[model samples]
Target: MTGVLAGALGLVVGLVIGTLGGGGGVLAVPALVYALGQDARTATTGSIVIVGIISAAGVLARLRGRTIDWRTGVGFGVVGVPTAWAGSLVNRAVPQPVLLLSFAALTLLIAVLMLVRGSSSARRTDGAGPSPGTPDGGSGVPAAGGGTSGATAVLEAPTRRRATVRRVAKIAGAGSVVGFLTGFLGVGGGFLVVPALTMLMGLSMPAAIGTSLLVLTFNSISSMGARIGHLDLDWAVIGPFAAVAVLGALGGKLVADRMSGAALNRAFAGLLVAVGLFVGVQSLLAL
Candidate 1:
């Protein structure tokens, strides 16, 4: 019966990842600890495995379309990898109750960000421009250039797009925050990454989402790597959990195609907030 419930829950989490580009581990961690009776630390490690594998599965379709920004994604990831290892070390030292409480707080924060992003998404749908939480820093229209040769014009386009010192610093900071949370909490931080990509890196929504999956996979790998010998493998639960999630994610992509964006955002936001509240209260009471 426990396995059955876990399977069903994994399917729901998978659906979120398949359509939303992330959020599987948010639901997965709490479910593993409270619902299926696993240790919080162990659940965090398992979440890396579950969500990381599922994210890899989710990115394959996007890869075929050449929507991923490999340069930006890898650049962002390079900063994240080592920070993730550091976070795992911190996770190992934290008390279980404190960790759970922190996780609950993080979940609530994610809920708020989702609400902000959702409102922004709604506004964009109404012609407010790029998603709401992201303020367009300058005139979004590209600067015009004139040159005698077409080759020079083409060459200049990329040179103009080269990363400014400001851009590198911003990505490094963003990578640190997202990587720490991923290593400590077992989330991919797509909630943060998608907006960062769109707002900072100037990626479109589709491109941001696709690239986030790759970013998440690396974050998870880094987190999991730090826990190598200490990990207590739970194949019985993990195997079934991941298998169902993969299938659920596949179906979710199909369902996502037909869903209304605003409505989905609102609904998902509410669910996140409610779950966050529950986890917060429960963890607090246990302490």
Candidate 2:
């Protein structure tokens, strides 16, 4: 019965994240701990397993339609995976309430960020800021290459090399920080990734969501590896919960393509603030 309920909840959480491209594992860990009665350590471990499986499923599905910016994803994963393992190890050492309180604070911070960033996203015009066509620091749209089409000899080469490199650096840095948090906190870190990808890396909303899921897969594996010997193994919890999360991820991916970006951003911001306030208050009460 407990497993069944957890799986059902996992499905709902997974669906929200996978479709919306956020919130799946953010909600999953708490559900596993508070509602399912798993220890904080076990819940963190289980979250890694569950998030990895579900994210992999989402990535595979997304691959059918769009080319995953693999170069960026792989680059970020390189630093992210190892850091994720380190994060898991750190989580094992922290006290439960402290970890929860930290989680609450981080979530709240993400909420405020989303609200601010989302508002900015709305007011901005296509060519208003430094984007693909503005100055070097802005979007950086380069001139056409030497080769021309038909009668002329000019190749259409935008400033891909420098732009790609810069984007990759930002993505990798974000991945590393997220991995560290995941290893330390035992949460999926999607909330952080979405905002980071958007505000820092400057990816499209859908791209950020998809890219974050890919990062989550690698991060989960790393965190799980770190937890292997340090803590008690509980396949009984990890297995079924992960299976359900995979289903939810598929649903989230579908929704991401359809939902209004503004609406999603606002809704997620509200959720973050509420969750943050609740956790912050909870932490104070326990002290």
Candidate 3:
């Protein structure tokens, strides 16, 4: 019975990660603790293993689709490595209830942000046509006979430069936060990664999902390395759990291909809220 439950939970976790490019860690940790009777620390350590493998599978599944932004994903991962290690150090010192509560709060906050971003994106899509610009929606170059002057061109160049710098800073900041959360909470941090890719880097939903998986894979590796000496391996549970999760991840990729970006965001947001609430309540009771 326990084995059956573990497989079912693992499938759910993989499906969430595969389809949404994140939230596997969020679901996996709780399932391990409550369903499989593991403690918080063990569950979190195991979550890193499960989420990492499945994320790698997800990245491969999307590779042929050409939806991943590898450059951005690699850059994000690079920035996150040190921070993830730091977060793991802190994770060992925190109490279980505090850790769980913190995870719940962060989860809820990200869900709200996702919903807001989704609504804003929908509004922009519905109410406005694409701006006059390059094929990729960049600002148009001034025509020779147009009323554009050298002075205006000079001013626009600096403005565009500053905007680019700001976007880069935002990406770096978001990556650090996601990495810290991944190590500290034993989560894939995809809930945050997808939004960062879409809102900051301007990737489409599919691209963001694929790239998010890559980022998760990197963060998971960094986090797991930090736990090498601290955690005891529970292969009995983690082994079978991860196997079924890989299969579910493949199925999830197919589901994601058919869904709209807005629908995916909405669904992801709803799931976060539900899980966050449950985790929050449970943590408070334990405290």
Candidate 4:
């Protein structure tokens, strides 16, 4: 009965990871603790293992589509490694209730952010004006007045350079935060990664999803490695869970391809809200 339950939960986690490019850890950790009878800390360790493997499988599933931005994903992952280790150290010191409460709060925060972003994107889509950065409002044609003056062109060059620098800095900062969360919570940090990649880095939905999986894979592995000596896994439960999740991930990828990005974002945000509320309520009652 426990084995069957684990498999069912694992499939759900994988589908979320594959379809949304995140949320697996958010689901996995809670399921491990509440359903499978694992302690909070052990559940986190197990979550890292499950999410990391599923993320790798997700990456492979998207490989043929060329939706991933390898350079960005690898750079983000590299920035996160040190912080992930640091977070693991902190994780060991925090009490279980505090950790779970923090996780619940963070999940709620991310859901709010996603909803805000989705609404903003919808507004932009409805507007008639060109996209913010485009000159002719996304018409692919130059403005009717022709090119800018020589002085304007000269100024724009430096502005573009500055923008690039700022973008790189933002990526590094976001990556560090994600890494820390991954280690501290035993989550893949995909809930945060997908938004960061799309909003900050300007990747399209498919690209962001694919790239998020790659980042999750890195964060999960890094966190898991830091917990190596302390980990006490129940392979009997995790083994079948992980195997079923891989198959679910493959199915999720197909579903994502057929859905609109806006719809996916809204759906993902709703799920987060529901889970966050449940987790938060349960934690408060326990306290």
Candidate 5:
């Protein structure tokens, strides 16, 4: 009964990850371990399945709205896929306490980024470049230099060679980090994805959110592959959890569209900070 209850709790975890990004999977591991009393390895495997399903649902929702930026998403996806698998392998090797501690700290860090608002951390441009999305940041727009209005346009051509290289490098670097985290932690990489897109790629909030979903999808698949040989592939666990997660993800997408962006960001940041504190305490306690 307790195990079933814990599995039910997994639905809530999936919903949060689907909606917010930072704390969902991070908390899911603990929920599976402590709430359900599963071994860390089993819990980690469970988290991967849950995160993947929720992320795919979110991507589907985003795609329906025509919000996904395929080019940027694919670019990030290419780098993240293999790394996510590697991360899953790492998760198998690491001690549970260490994983929890690292996850907690990451959650807190993302929360801070959420509060800062992507624009504040963005590389300064004197508002000269074309905006990446809607004039108000709601409408998905074309790549700045793509000379088209469609959201699918390739990323804007960098004005300076140095800047272009730097931007590409940043995207690749962020993708790698996000991939590893996803595989290792069973997260969808939303905490890092949104800020990285907004701050580094100059994408608007809507675009970033949409793009992150795609990146998450690719990362999940890659990581799942890593678990294939070592773990039990439990369809029994995946079925109910995925159904609830998909429903919750759909609801979250609606909420995301309705909420005030600034307020949401602030709330998310605070949440991250709280999660981080929890992780730090868990790590210390482990010692």
Candidate 6:
């Protein structure tokens, strides 16, 4: 009975992870603990295995689409390794209830981020910005004489240097935060990774999703590896659950091509809010 329940739930979770990435896998923790009768700590460990394997399928589904940006994805993932380990250490010091409340709060935060991202996307599309034909840096005109003067090049060099530094900082900061959450909560961090890749790293939505899956795969490994000896996962349960989810994820990735990302984001945000509210209420009552 438990196996049947777990396999059923894992399929749904994998579909979400394959279709949406990021925060989608966060649902696994709650499902594992509340629906499947796993302990909170064990659930986190299992989430890594499930989400990671499913994300691998998502990555493969995206392979021929040219949706991935390898350099940015790998760089972001590399920065997260140590932080995820640190987050796992922190996780052990916290009580189960408090950890759960923290997870609920994180869910709420992700929902808010989704709405804000949607709004921001709309604004970017309609805002008073440069026309598509505008010159470099959105300047009103092309460079002098259709080329830059040596003096102009010298002047712009420092500006470009500053821009590069800022870009690095943005990437590093986003990766660190996502990495910590990955380790601390055993989630793949796809919710945070998609937006960060799109907004911070200038990837398109499809590209971001693909790249985000790769980064999430790294995060899952980091999180699960940190818990290697600390947690004992039930292979009988995890095996069937992960295998089913892998198939579901592949199917979801196929269907994702026909779906609207905005619609998906809105629907996901609503679900997160509902789940967060329920968890918040339950935790408070228990306390």
TM-score of each: 0.81, 0.83, 0.91, 0.93, 0.78, 0.90
Give the alpha carbon lDDT tens digit for every residue of 15-108 in model 2.
Answer: 8678656566667777777788777677777777777788788888888765255655666667888888777777877898888889888998
Worst 10 residues of 1 by lDDT: 139-148
Off by over 4 Å in 5: 2-8, 117-163, 233-238
lDDT of 4 by residue, 135-244 (tens): 66674544446765565668779999999899789889999999999999988889889888988898988888999999999998899889989989999899988989
Ranking by TM-score: 4, 3, 6, 2, 1, 5
Residue 17 deviation, candidate 5, in Å? 3.2
User: RMSD to the native, candidate 6?
Assistant: 2.7
**What TM-score would candidate 3 get against the native?**
0.91
lDDT of each: 0.78, 0.74, 0.89, 0.90, 0.71, 0.80
Model 3 misplaced regions, further than 4 Å = 129-141, 144-160
Question: lDDT, candidate 6, residue 66?
Answer: 84
Candidate with top TM-score is 4
Ranking by lDDT: 4, 3, 6, 1, 2, 5
Candidate 2 Cα outliers beyond 4 Å, as residue runs: 126-165
Report the C-alpha displacement of residue 29, candidate 1, in angstroms. Answer: 0.4
Per-candidate clashes come to 1, 20, 0, 1, 2, 3
In angstroms, how far off is 71's CA in candidate 2?
A: 2.2
Residues 1-287, candidate 6, lDDT per residue (tens digit)? 87887788878887877776655566788888888788778888888888888887888888787878888888888999889888888887878898789888988887888789888888888876666777453765445787756777788889999999987898789999999988887777887788687667877666777888899888888887788779779877888888888888877776666777777667667767887887778778878
Q: List the pairs of residues colliding in candidate 3.
A: none
The top-ranked prediction according to lDDT is 4
Cand. 1 TM to true fold: 0.81
Q: Write the per-residue lDDT of candidate 5 for residues 100-208, one digit (tens) a residue.
A: 7777878876666656554564434445454575465554654558767443433444336668687779879988988988888776677777777766787766667
